[model samples]
Target: MTTNHLELSGRILRSRRFDSPAGIHHTVLQLEHKSLKTEANMQRQVYCVIQVILSGERFERLTDKLKAGVDIQVSGFIALQQSRNGQSRLVLHAENVELKN
Candidate 1:
């Protein structure tokens, strides 16, 4: 409902299999750090969601391309992820996730 999500960048700590009912496949990567600011703020220590989707013959291309300890940049909406135990967590739905310095 909100398009006012903040952008975050980091590295992948966790990568999971993401698939759809239409035979579309994707990979979810967990980042380790993020920068919070318009002009370049390096003090923010935030994590993010990085998803790499494969279209056409690009299925296994990005799947094994990215791994743990690799740096990445992510841009997406952040929201509260509710667990079955009633606990809440902030998660990211990365619209644009890429490799970076």
Candidate 2:
């Protein structure tokens, strides 16, 4: 068996809500993260921007709070999504979201 899980904390750079043709609600967030980490036994600064997607009615309650500039932590799985142009990118599908003080 294999497992795929990830947890990340970052500031929301952008947020948007949309409905699919089947009426499924989806919330997309662009998150920016900056932190210091130990790599190769040395301290290094890490910075990244990633896309997070929250889907279904279960995440409705948290949608309103997923606004730009809000600091939040999200726990979920990562998947590759292909766009219309056939380019694939990594996206985090959030299962849990929390506000960070």
Best by the lDDT measure:
2
TM-score of each: 0.60, 0.96
Misplaced by over 4 Å in model 1 are 1-3, 20-26, 34-61
lDDT of 1 by residue, 1-101 (tens): 63566666667787777667886766766667655544374555444454433233354565675788887766667667677999887767656657776
TM-score (C-alpha) between model 2 and the true structure: 0.96
Model 2: per-residue lDDT, tens digit, 25-64? 9999999999999999999999999999999999998899
RMSD of each: 5.0, 0.7
Model 2 residue 30 CA deviation (Å) reads: 0.3
Worst 10 residues of 1 by lDDT: 48-57
Identify the runs in model 2 with alpha carbons over 4 angstroms from their true place: none
RMSD to the native, candidate 2? 0.7
